[model samples]
Target: MAMRVLETITNMTQLCQKIVHINIRWSVLNKVPFFRQSFRFLWDRILMCSVGKSIQYRRLHRCASSPSPAAIECKFASGDPTTTCTDYDKDSDLVALKISLLGDCQIGKTSFVIKYVGDEQEHRCLQTTGLNLMDKTLFIKGARIAFSIWDVGGDHRSLDHVPVACKDAEAILFMFDLTSRCTLNSIIGWHRQARKWNQMAIPIIIGTKFDDFVQLPLDMQWTIVSQARMYTKAMKATLFFSSATHNINVNKIFKFITAKLFNLPWTVERNLTIGEPIIDY
Candidate 1:
């Protein structure tokens, strides 16, 4: 009985070895384009049921034991795992500015930021729950300025947190949807609320979705633009018409603000033609 048990144990060890060898061959075969799609489902199931966990454990252990020195140095230098060594510049002046976006819900505040930052646009508009923060570094006039942008949710329930988020903000962008009169009407309230939190921050009124607004009848379009201009004057804020989807007036808005704040010179191109409109977008 002892001899039989020993033989069985030896056979089982040999079988596991053969299975491992076959798995290795299968791994190589799985990389082939012709076999990949056909074998992927079966390979995944086999790995999950047999060797996946063990292989992952071994790999993690190996990595834990021997971390690369270059990676360690990079981690220490940046102090942020998401930031790489190349992203840091020793000679650039790092000025941190906080800007808050305030507006009614679905008015394209988040969309505008994403477009300006060169991020992919979401197909569906997402309602911001409380506050969404994004960071961007801009190099203007040989100076590096880092902007910390906060997008405050426009929902009534989220409005309570707006004051807290707006603290220490250097500027506030109050946006409204040009196609929605209700959103435009709500701009004054949003501006007041933001000013209550940070009075020193410069305020700018942004009229979004201009592409859709322009498609309306001439009279209706003029009405909306006139109302927006009135609000801009009343609030003593600069007004800009923008379309994030079309990448219009997005970068120009930020550039104008930066130039104004830093006392930098910015030249505006004028349209000499009498009947033709100036194309600034």
Candidate 2:
């Protein structure tokens, strides 16, 4: 019985690899009929297999509505696994996604991620010379989903990591310090660099340190937000103002991504009030 189970598992692995190969060759093949049948077969087999770990969702709300993304340009799967996640995710059948965070130095990229993944997981994050990698898993309808986040340091020396970080990423977040216009201005260059590797990754503009931003004069806030909105329109990306300290818009950002990807209904209103954090599409 043990040998039989091993053979079945091995066959399942090979089938999954073939399906992934088809996805990689999608544009070149353009064989809709073949892919349709292939995926149908794959799904039937997957549904019958009852293996993989169960992870609890991290404050993820039950989504009832269909997903509505701001734009649909390109898509890519996760790159080669860079680091092993905590044991919590091993052997799990969760849909793993790659997310990239790019910005100038000390723009709160690490803090933003730490808040979402939690402090314990933060300690397990791999801190290399120029990159940081963290993983988080969420449970949805008994199925598990994982996000392997790549944070490229915002200095010139760390620029080499951009291509690796962006490659195969499903989403790329271009972050900036809300109090510094210069950091915000750096978004154009960062966007250009990232687009070189993956053009289809969902783009998101995030302004960090909202707690400090609100203390500025209302006129200054208006000017900054106006510029941010312009940038968002230019990139055709979603815009969000967040504070890791206060946990403002931090969770909502990931929730938005999940909803958009899964076609789940999301009810988020645009907030343009000067004193409040902004969420504009």
Candidate 3:
């Protein structure tokens, strides 16, 4: 906070100096004594106006009750379940990131969230009529990263919950059942609905039940993979073949999200093999 204030002050000071220098140069070039005399009065008013507006803007952001944006990021290592995901609900400094899960019913949308948030936190989930909300707080480095995950029911009634679930979300996960092609097709609709509420949230296409998906014939797997890749391309999203049951690519997905959000180095390589759990960006 101190550093930010100092930096803001230094930047405003330099900017004021530049503006004053430019105006003084203009007055001197024109060789007008009256303009020179007026420049001092104008300069005084300009500096006062600039400082007043800058202070006003800073005051607006200085609300003590509002949650601050996440600045301290901990190294989120992929494929390691122990890196984070603790129950840090009381931490006032915890930077909360909202994530919405959209998919068809029985397509493992809730299961996918449970897999990432863990079974212990499953009891903490707040389930209402159409929406399922769960929270997972991660202790990273010295800061807390909380994920407020909203899973909307796949039924038609859940459409009402989409707007609330997606509004101000940091990322939205579009899930599908790998064994069901119709479920995969519905993801585009879900994506459209989510975008209506938030166009800036990171879009991710997740194929659930990958374990069962691999049990199908090799040709079917190839077809499903190709279709998934095509949809991923169309949506301009990152695709991950996941299984809540087997826990494949479950933790890794959130790690990828955390790393991306904080601009951390992502060490996971892309995999396009049909039989393997694919991770494509």
Candidate 4:
């Protein structure tokens, strides 16, 4: 009888393990990317309080009221699961800025974005397949603006599908390399395509590799800038000459975007735009 009882217990454990594996697989395929992260986070917390040392974690959390470093770290590392959801909650008016990059392949579009968010520029960037979506929240003045930037594929073959990914963007950043004439020429087509996605939105013309322009003929460089500025001005778009390698006015671009979109007073700096309006539209 004891042998039979032990056998039954073992079978139950095996069954539970199989069930857990199947559940994880389903979650990974159907749920958000952060679902696994959330599971791991909850599991870690549970383990810390149970099998692991509970008092140490409690002290760590107590040191920081509200969201502890541990919690913020988890959110940053895991990314907010809310952003991946297909539909956002309509009740809450959380302003979400959809930004996309438009330029030729290998034109430092991805590098530029990573530099803004990661604060570093490296040539080791792999081609973005389909789309790469990331979120960063900036606190300007007093409000918060959540930026959901999508780095779409810059491959020539991928141009047809690019507009679909850029739908509902609050702004589009058309990036071109200062040294690459091919990338610079592609900007016109990219801008036309992006306009189809969001007609009334703002477009920011960004000239990458601004540092390298000194090596090129000054007249040629100014002519390029003039052509870009003319196109942007015609479309009522903003233009900026920036080098991600130098981090010049990278902060200013985001801040100015906040001010333009939210129509906040220009005096406040480093302030996030508030999503909630006093009067509901």
Candidate 5:
């Protein structure tokens, strides 16, 4: 009986080896470019499986009524896996959000991001040459949210560069300074151009530096609010005002984004427990 079982196991191993060899040859026999494309397709399909760790919609909502984004775009350079996350398993939808801040130079776009990410105050306020990116893992209810936030230069000269920044975004946050009427006026043109380029559904209009003036005239504030509301309503977007310096309504902006992008309830404290420390899963 032992000899018979050993013979069966050896035969099975040999068969498996032959099958693998045949598959390798078959894969290589295809055109080299075709083989390369097929390999990439398979790799992306495998990564899509990780979406199981991401949000799983109970029901698909209409485009007009969907609370969260339909996809998420993770930022990963050619060889940098340290920053990008792949914790989700198969069958996950990738939500891609492209956000760009446009206003005159020194409108506090970088400051807003630093505050949102809770970066140190003295951290070098380096002018974003082209684009800067930061990732934040958000929790909407118990669901995991990974957002890639891109901070683009807001100078008018950068307007030509905006399309590249806003390309393929599921949502966008258009921010302008509360105190600068010129900055406020530019939003209309910017919004029109961005909509033409991206044609995205989810958008947010933000007024930054609310704490700059003790009290902005009611009419001035209302005018800015009305302008933003008009555009947001036209684009079907949410609107908000925030101060990154004082940390006022910063969480509110995040909550709005989480709710809009993931359709999940917002919470300040995260409840995720670290199991075994994964060196590299």
Candidate 6:
């Protein structure tokens, strides 16, 4: 009976050793690229299954108690966020400005705002129902500028609210989709309304979806550019071609506008191709 017990113990020890060997092999396999990718795919699937979509949108507001400009960060909340005191320094003589974005429906206004504010892009595009407001504070040439950006919906029903939003705006960004010629043409009416509301506001003409626009035939590309230049000249507005998705000229647009508005000396270097304008493509 003692001999039988000893044999049983030896078999159990061998089984335990085999189990440890299998675990070590698995650990090594996880480090391999192919096995790692396969594991990641499975893990993502498991996570998706476990956490079904229950996504919620929260508004971000800045806290007033934050004393320093660098320390001010957005605070998440359930309702429409209000402006915070950190947006200005009373002692520094900060300037508060309102900027309005005007454009037709589905013309990438919201996408531009999201990209500017460092937010993730939404996979599906949705129309803005009424108005969406975002605030950003910028330090330019020893002066603090607080901007209250208002994005008004472009539907016909939302047109009534445009005058109110544009009433005291310091600057206006008029956007149009490059893929749609109708949207480009509609800018005239939008510009007219903006001028009627705030004649002093600096106007900027932005051509959105520039990535898709460049894929068109060369002649068509030049035609749109010519039209943009004509309208810009007539309206005395700065012209910019931008693609929020590709991050093309997105930051430059705002920087140029701020510099122009503040009368700050700004210079941009570009390689000229003989016939092309020196603007950043």
Cα-based TM-score, every candidate: 0.61, 0.71, 0.70, 0.57, 0.57, 0.61
Check candidate 2 and list the clashing pairs. Answer: 65-264, 65-265, 67-263, 67-264, 74-200, 94-144
Better of 3 and 6 by TM-score: 3
Per-candidate count of clashing residue pairs (backbone under 3 Å):
0, 6, 0, 7, 19, 0
lDDT of 3: 0.80
Worst 10 residues of 2 by lDDT: 71-80
Over 1-281, each residue of candidate 5 has an lDDT whose tens digit, in order, gives 99999999999999999999999988878668897898998886676566532223431222223333322112111122443343545313334344565555677877888776546322533345666776554333233346566677765667777777677665677777877877767777777877877875467767778786337776666666566567666756665666887876665566555555555433233211222100110
Local accuracy of candidate 4 as per-residue lDDT tens digits, 35-117:
88899889867875575323332433344234333432333331244322323334122345777778887777766777666
* Candidate 6 pairs with clashing backbones: none
131-242: candidate 2 lDDT, tens digit per residue? 9999886644444567899999999999999999999888999999999999999999999999999998899999999999999999999999999999999999999999
- In terms of lDDT, model 1 sits at 0.67
The runs of at least 3 residues in candidate 6 whose Cα sits more than 4 Å from the true structure, single-residue gaps closed, are 1-92, 120-128, 267-281
**lDDT digits (tens) for residues 170-189 of candidate 1:** 77888889889999999989
The lDDT of each candidate is: 0.67, 0.81, 0.80, 0.61, 0.58, 0.67
Q: What is the C-alpha RMSD of each candidate to the true structure, in Å?
A: 18.8, 16.7, 15.8, 17.4, 14.3, 20.5
Instruction: State model 5's lDDT.
Output: 0.58
lDDT of 3 by residue, 56-152 (tens): 2233234322222232223433324654566565654456778989999999988888877777778978999989999876655445677899999
Residue 181 displacement (Å), model 5: 1.4
Q: Model 1 TM-score?
A: 0.61
Error of 4 at 227 (Å): 1.5
Clashing pairs in 4: 139-272, 140-270, 140-271, 140-272, 141-270, 141-271, 143-272
Evaluate model 4: give its TM-score: 0.57
Could you tell me which 10 consecutive residues in candidate 5 have the lowest summed lDDT? 272-281
- In candidate 1, clashing pairs total 0
